[model samples]
Target: MRQYFPSNLKHLCSHYRSISDVCNRLKIHRGQFNRYLAGTSFPTSFNQKRICDFFGVEAHEIALPTDQFLQLISSRTPRPTLAMITAPQRAVEHLRQCSSSRLQDLVGHYHEYAYSISHQGRILCSLVSVKELDGHIVYERVEPSASRSNGSDRTSCYRYEGVAYYLGDRLFLIDYESLATSEINQTILIPSFKTRNARLNGLKMGVTACDHRVPVCSRVVWSSLGTKACGPEAFRKVREYRDDDQELDSDLKARLAKAQIIDGLFRII
Candidate 1:
């Protein structure tokens, strides 16, 4: 079946500074690229995916109205200005500004309150640090939890390292398990910067209750541990918080179960 590059796709290709450059990157023949640019015909499914990936756009974007496509792409893939790829030191500073967005301005330690995947109404407590050094923003996380499911007793620790940045209104940390599975964790932290218990809420891509795995949404939340520099002494506070523990502050429990940010036992500023 013959198809054509929709108006939106053509517009997206036009926005690029050079058609030849786009063709070279996409590895599409110059004639073929021009055909698509003219909206005379579309590429094969594989080529469509390549083109969309090259543009950092969704495949469905080809069918979207120009305005909607523009809006969607604008938010997800902000136009890379010449300022970002410039060779001079000032240009480098301009690029750094995006990674060091307003949210990343709060870089330090936090009492990560991740919702447990194995048990219901329980929380996993850990320590995480977000730091920006030499214009590179990065985060380190350490989660310690015990699996008591199936009457088994085994303890495990999950450590992750990844890049942290703010996109739109939320802060995101994209990390992978280095020593273990290559599973990618997309953690979205909704910050109420001055709110008492402000922390990054989390979501693991897949829910695995001990060997049993399912594609379900597991609840996760984060609470700021504090911004103070830490040492070996600070590591003692992490624990598994079940709903009934007396040590678990009521406000914190509410925040974990109900996703509320309050200022009681812990506060972030």
Candidate 2:
């Protein structure tokens, strides 16, 4: 019944500057918007109302078969536009435009370290790779964990795909957990200005994977592993480690410690 929804939604979005613009207007995550565009999932009734209200169409009308839906909106006026795009949107666009030129130096593999959300008191290391794609910087992160479930060694992997932006001397990365699709993570790191890329430290904000799903914030460190280590061998290294694990050096371990407020300001040193 909703087969036409994807195509109709695409048609509506084509009138905007970009799908990003449409998602911004609808207050939807870009990753979730893509699922609707690809027909892999349907928007909930609440989202349907938001979409319908934004496009001046009825819910039933949007579900019409493509040909009829096209004809229905044929005489519709041009897509609406604000007197000026919001300042935040303009800033985002500017950052996206700047990412391609500014992030080449950081396009490589990294070992991402953070306090484990699933296994408290352990440090988790995930494999991450960043690269330039179509004038935009995109990255993929893979988390591989091994545990004994039902008396058997089972490995569970979680993957995330996200975009990176360098704006105002800081690197911003936002991604949704692709495997679960229930979490969106944001990391803000200090960009490396040195001639050589080095360990970059930042804060990560996201909900835990536990059943309770408590929101947690933790300090994270990205250690450059260069371009060659992003293959299968790299993934082998993605797992949790004890605090005394030799792989986690003293300096790196120090950086990932949970932060505390000092003088009314939270700091990750």
Candidate 3:
């Protein structure tokens, strides 16, 4: 479907000099906002909401299909596909006990908790130093083409430090870096293994224009497994296996089970 932003936004504030004006108000850069105006890029749902707040407009108005078209550029580059990891049998058995509804609830809760931690404006603008204790896993911040429209499209600018690890059934983010450490205290969602490839090659993570801005990392887990872990509802579904009363359909249950099992073996070293 085609997408667009409201035309009236340009005419609203007389003092607004350029897309830069809007971005400055929004705390984003001029070029990034220009991409949105030109229809060469599309903002993620989170950014779309931020843009709406900046312009004093509704989210729907700022994300009109035609606006997306204006910034649309056709690229024929082929993206990399994520590698499939094997899940543990024990994890599958554990997930089989829960219903779909319960699983949804688990994912939802996790998402809300994570969002609350990240939305507090704590992690923005900081120099983070990264270190891998276990292995040669290098985590570098990159600016992906997908984030070009978000008004902070600078490439690999911010130096945020954090260690990424794989838990039993999820990915965890711990802030050990000096930058924004006091403000950000807790494990946040970096990305799930299922969606790691999309985040790395397609959506781009760890890159932000401003010093204190929260990096825009696409929740690729949702796109990869056809489910989201960014909200309470989705979290419940992923964790539903812990429930005993209801049962999900075989296919969905299998996927969740697999995700859980895979999460156990891949320790981010």
Q: Write the per-residue lDDT of candidate 1 for residues 1-269, one digit (tens) a residue.
A: 12334567667767677878778767789898788767777788899887776666667766676777677767784654332343574444444576435855657787766566666666667777888776667788876756522223554667888776666666767786667764667776666757643655545444564666654444456666577787775565566766687866776666555433356422222
Which scores greater on lDDT, model 1 or model 3? 1
- Determine the C-alpha RMSD for candidate 2 after optimal superposition of all C-alphas: 13.5
**Which ranges of candidate 1 are over 4 A from the true structure?**
1-23, 26-100, 147-156, 193-205, 259-269
Task: Report model 1's TM-score to 2 decimal places.
Answer: 0.54
Span of ten consecutive residues with least summed lDDT in model 2: 144-153
- Give the Cα lDDT of each candidate: 0.64, 0.82, 0.34
* Model 2: residues with Cα > 4 Å off, grouped in runs: 1-92, 98-100, 146-153, 229-232
Error of 2 at 190 (Å): 1.2
Candidate 3 global CA lDDT score: 0.34
By TM-score, how accurate is candidate 3? 0.22
Ranking the candidates on TM-score from highest down gives 2, 1, 3
N/CA/C clash count, model 1: 2
Order of candidate numbers by lDDT, starting with the best: 2, 1, 3
TM-score of each: 0.54, 0.62, 0.22
Assess candidate 2 and give its lDDT: 0.82
